[model samples]
Structures are given as structure tokens and as C-alpha cells.
Target: MGWARQKQQHHNAAFFWRYLLMASALCLVFFTPLCRAGAENHRNAYATMMYMGTPRDYEFYVAIRVLLKSLAALHVDADLVVIASVDVPARWVRALEKEDGAKVVRVENMDNPYKKQANFDKRFKLTLNKLYAWSLVDYDRVVMLDADNLFLRKTDELFQCGQFCAVFINPCIFHTGLFVLQPSMTVFKDMVHELEIGRENADGADQGFISSYFPELLGQPLFHPPANGTRLEGTYRLPLGYQMDASYYYLKLRWSIPCGPNSVITFPGAPWLKPWYWWSWPVLPLGIQWHEVRRQTLGYSSEMAVVLIQCAIYIGIIGMTRLARPSLSKLCYRRSDKSTYLVQNCLKLVAFWCILAAYIAPFFTIPHTVHPLLGWSLYLLGSFALCSIAVNAFLLPILPVLVPWFGIIGVLLVMAFPWYRDGVVRALCVFAYSFCCAPFLSAAVSKIMVALQLTFEREAFLPRLGESNPPSGFNKLY
Candidate 1:
């Protein structure tokens, strides 16, 4: 009986052990989370950009997409991400995911946290949300880059560096672009706290917060991990290649040491020098590479597209105006004598059409061999076009398209040609020959000009034959 009892107990114990082992194996095979394994596999740090909103925000997103495509083309293994707010259109988000195989992380829009003000208009705004980048704990390390940054060569080795690293943007100032950082919410919170209570920097936006937080560390030696598996904490200055400013690069060649093969080229500061700026091609050759990326990948010049749409809308309004008025199109720009023939009238109409075409030409294609003055005109014209399209104050749809050209060309004509320079006199001469249908349009515009002349200088418009410049009748009219 004792031998049988001992054998039964041993058999039960073996069965229990077998059952436990089977369950453990099944759990190990089935229940382990793939997320952890996937994350562990992709342990390398990532780079990201931010764009909250702009009138031309679409172009900005397209630029980001182009950067990602460039990375893929080079067969770079690093992931590129963009954290945008709800203000960014949904189409931009989809493009980032579908076309570029990039990630789009949406965060709430935050205002500029830094209290400091920039001395000049810095072309970019609402960049304080960059702080949220540090909150992405998924990435063991992160390299934050400005959306305007274009990568030239592979910078994957940057991940081997320490937690905090950046390049000098301004003299003695570290640029936030292309900075390596370890993801931690604590750092994010501390930045927020500093922004709220601490003094803001002179440059404003993200530069202030980053510069303040990492002060006196520009020249500091960074953490160099020893072969024995231990690490130290320090901030490292990035090589010039990482944050190469385009303006400063040329300036260095002129006055200072010219830098070598830059890893990234940062087009910052001037709004016009940006890759997708309206006059990017002719105004600044530096933006051409970025412009090419935009054209080849996106299928069109993104900046010119916005201008084209605005022009089309203006044309539609002009067409509708012509349809409604009927007589306006047939009328001549000059009120010429038509008793013998309408030849001069026809010539006047032809000149008006030519002027209209001239206005639209620059938006379509900038001439490669333009004079310096024409380049300046393109630059000015580009600014006026962008602002006019985005402006709410200009209710007259046609005015945006017409006014800038007329203003620039008219001012030029006034300077060189005697007729346009003395606008009021020319306007009066047209009014004097008030026999044609075009005279009414001229008369209305002339009156507005005269009113402006009187309002500001009160002597810009010369008085009529009977009245003084500041007429004695002015008091009675009031």
C-alpha cells in the first residue's frame, strides 16, 4: 500500500509540471505585445518638423513631404515626422502618410509661449508648439528640425551622439533646428514653466525658450559614452553642416571661413528666400533646389499655383464685370477722337489688353535673364500678390491683380515718362476729351486720386483755373 501511494503522488506531480510548462509556452508565443518588440527593433532616433498655419501652409506641408521623399530617395533609414495642429488641412495629413510613408502626429494649437518680441518680422510664427516634441517618449532620442531645413547628406550617425546637441545659428546662440534630444515629458513641462515665468529672448518664438533653457552650454562638451557602457550628461555643439544658414554661408565665404559639405541647408529669416516663396526662382538662386523638388514631386510650382488661382478668380470677376457692364470692354483706355475712324480707339484698347497680359506674365514664368530692376520688381510683385490673396481688407477682387502692377509700373512710368508721373494732369486731359465711353471710368478714378491728394498734402492736386490749391470753397464743402 505504501509503494502504490508514493507512485500515485509522483505521477500527479509530473502531470502538474507538464501542464504548467505548456501554459507558459503558449502565453509566451501568443500574449507578448508586438508593439514593444517593434519599438525595440526601431530603437534609432527620429527627426521631425512643425507647421501650424500659414496662408501658404499647403506649400509648407508640400515642402515637408518633399523632404521625406528626398530621404526615401537617398535610402535613409531614419523616420521623418511632422506634428501639426487641427488648423492644417486634412489633405496635407493624408499626403504625409500615403505618399511619403511618414507619420503625422496631431497636437492642440498653442500660442507663442515666449514673451520676447523679434526686432523684425521673422517670416515664421506660432513655433512654440515645438516643445511638444519632447513629449514623444516613444522615440528614445529625437532630432528636431525646422520645416524649412533641407537635408543634403545622411545624418543617421547623429543618433550615436548624446541626448542634447545643436549648432550655432546666431553668434553665441544655438539654433533649435537639427538638435538631438532625449524624449521626456519632464523637459517639455520645464520648458513650458520657463516660458511662463522666465525671461524671453530677443528673437522670439522657439529660439527664446531653447536658448534660455540651454544657456552657457554652447561651448560645453557633450556626453561621450565610454566603451564600458556608462554615459555622462552634457550639451554638444552640432557641426555647421547640421544647421547651415543660407545667408550666413555666403557671408562666411565673403568675410569669414567658408564651411564645407553641409548636411542640411536652412532657408530661414527672409520670407522671400524660402523654397516655395513666390519669386524663389529668380529672386534667390539658393531656393532653386527646393523649388525643383517642389515641381518634380508636387507636379507644379506651389507658390505660383496660389498666385494663379487668385489671378483666375480675378479674371472671373473681370469677366462677370464685362458681362454686366458690356460697354466697359468695348471702351478705349484713351478717350480718342473717333469722327474719322476708331483706329486710335482700337490702338488704345489693344494697349490696355497688352498691359493686362504684362501683369499676368511674371506670375506664369519669370524670365531667366532679367535685369536687376526687373528682379526687384519680381520681388515686390511677389510680396504684393501673396499678401493680396491672403488679405481680407481688400474687398475689390480685381484691385489686387491690377493695383500693384499699376502702382509699380505707373511709378516707373512717372519717373521715366512725363505722362504717368503727373497722374492728375494726364487724368484731367482724359477728362477733357470726355467724348468716349472710357471717359467715365477715367473720371471716377481721377476723382478718387484727387481726393487722396487733397487729404494728405492738400496741395498734391493743383487747383482748377478758378480755385486755389486749398480752395476758399473747401470750408463750404465741409
Candidate 2:
């Protein structure tokens, strides 16, 4: 009788396991079509690029119209969706609406915060309004382009890429500028909710909100294209033209190069005053005449020298701080018995000199204009060095304190359940390496370089002073 009972129990367990496996298979089969259908409905059959701005801004209108004309030339066959928030005179909106392939969407919810001129806050409100307008559109693939952006080449190939979400590599953060989204009203609503939450939490700018939710909204469908001009391989795509950030151009000089034919120039923030408007003519390479034409027509290049100078100053400060840490530490020890005023003064002076040197390096190398290769090299090298130092100085010191705790957690997770050991162990390893080891390793390298005095020299390798200047025909104002 006991043997018979044991056999019955074994049969029951086997039956349960078989039932579970069949159920899992059935669920996968059932949802496969639904998932595929959702993706298909949002695929890039009809592409639309949305620009939200007030029509009353004449310069912005001119920039948008020129961009539309360029897109038309490209034979994109995609609709240009422009959302006008302000009370654009009926005539102006009508004129743009009458354009053959352009769709002017008027958003009534946009509030004019300032009674006089629109400011950053108003722009944010306008963006939200435009986002709402996008929700109403029935397009499959939607891209949000800043009005300052001028398309120099055809972007139909971008839609040809079989990705649901595509974005240009955002140079500052590990993100992108021109994002190709699978348009859905639900996703748009979720984005608005997240933005509202960000505003309430004081998390960051709107872009921050968007970036934070990017992983969730796109759900592993998100892709970052390669550096402009690279051939697409293994799902990696590039933008049509170089998408420029006005702030990066003016402040960082990171996007001054016309990397390839399909590069689109994008200017974040105010659209009217762009560095490219001034520097595009003289600096543009001979083969890239289309960019020059776009710059001439739109009157902005998304490049600026002042911003580049500021970026250099920032890099210099970071470099000097890293370089002077040892000296400062010694000074503190020597002055322990006395007032620390002398040491403080000396440190401040060092910082000031470093910043001044950094600021002036660009001027001495390339003054009055911008050079793509020289500018990008300085920006990249300086940023890399600064990041290396930052990691070493800040992150390395905390590793020893955290490593044991991380190891213990890893062991606990692994021992807690043998069935989930593989995934948990892999996750813990990634967390431990990323949070604990990477920073220390980077910092150690930076410290070693500093000790050897193998510092990066900005002026020696970059473009020499007066290499390029603003275009002769460029207007100071839009």
C-alpha cells in the first residue's frame, strides 16, 4: 500500500509539470500574433517629422519652410507636421497649410506664460502641446525635428531600417537627438504623465524625462545609430545628415563637421540664432554644398564659438582640479598648525589659471570661427580626460568600502534559489563591476597620467588661430 501511494505522488508531479509547460507554450502562441500586429500597425509606412513652434516667429517660419522645401526635394513622401501654438495670423497659417505636402497643426492648449516674449518655460509648454498634437496624428513612424534643423539629404532610407524606435546618438548623454518613434496615443499619454511627474519631482529638463522613460516606452526596440556616415550593419543605423545641437555647437563645437551626405543639422533651444548661420559658408567643405544651401536658406548652423569657449573653460577647470589635488593635500598638511588662508588662496589661483588657460586655448588655436576636425578633437580628448579623472577621483575611493557588501549580496542571491542562479549571478556581476570596479579602474589610470604629467594639450594639435571665421554675408540677427 505504501509503495502504491509513492507511485501515485510521482505521477501527479509529472502531470503538473507537463500541464505547466503546455500552458506556457499556448500563451506564447496566443500572444505572438497580437505582438506582431501591434508592431506592424506602428511600422514606418508613413513617416512624419513634427516641428512645434509659433508661426508669428518669422525667422522660425522661414527656417521651417526652407526645411520643408528641402524635404520635398529629397522626395521623402513623408508629411511635414508643424504645430503652431501662438495665435499665428490666419493668413500665415493658411499660407503654410496651403503648401502642397505640409500639414500645419494648430494647438490651442499651449499657454503663453509671458505676455511679451516666449521664454524657456513657454517653449516647454509648447513642446507638450506639440506632443499632444502628435498623438492625434495617424502616422506609423514619427520623428520630432527642431525647427532650426535643415535637412540636406533624403531620409527615406532611415524609415527603411526595420526598427520600431531609432534615435541619433546624443553626444552629451548616451542617447540620441532625432528619434524615430512608433507612434501610439497611449505612448504619448504615458510620456506626458512622465513629464508631469518630472516637473513635480524636479527631476530634470523635459529631455531627461523622455530619456528616463525611453527604455520603458520603447521596450528594447530602441536603437542608437552609428556615428554619421558609417554604413549600417547589424541593425545599427545613421541619421540622414549630421544632427547638430546648437548648444553643443556654440558651447562644445562637437558637431561642426559635415560627416557625410545624409547629415541633418539640428539646433536645440532657440532656433533663430545658430552658429552655423554665421560659420557655415566658409567652413563647409566643397563637396557639401547642400549643407551650405540649407544653412543659407534656414539662416542657422547650430554652431557657435562662444559656447565652445565655455566648454573649454569647463574642461580646463576639471583638469586643473585633478592636477592640483596632490599639491592641495600637501598644503593642508603643512598648514595644519597655522591658518589655511595661504593654501586656500594658492589653490584658488591655480584653479583660476587653469580655467583661463582652457578658455584661451581655443582662441589661440581657432579664433573667430569653427573647424570640425580641430574642434571635435579638442572636445573629445578633453572630455575623455576629464571623465577619466572624474571617475578616478570620485568613484575609486568608494570601491573598497562597497566590494565586500556587493560580494555578499551576490552570494546571497545565488544561494537563495538554485533555479534562478544563472540570471541572478549575471546581474550581480554586472552591478558589481559597473558600480564598484569600473570607476576605480578609470580613476587609477587618470591618477597615473597626472603623475607622469602626460596631460592633453589643446592648442598644439587643434586648428590654429584664425583658421575660419563667420561667413561674410551672414546676418548678426535672424
TM-score of each: 0.56, 0.40
- Name the TM-score of candidate 1: 0.56
Number of the predicted model whose TM-score against the real structure is largest: 1
Candidate 1 wrongly placed segments (more than 4 Å): 1-41, 113-125, 222-233, 249-261, 295-357, 360-478
Off by over 4 Å in 2: 1-56, 110-123, 133-137, 161-177, 195-205, 215-261, 269-272, 275-478
| Residue 275 lDDT, candidate 1, scale 0-100 | 62
Q: How far is candidate 1 from the true structure (C-alpha RMSD, Å)?
A: 15.7
Model 2 lDDT vs. the true structure? 0.45
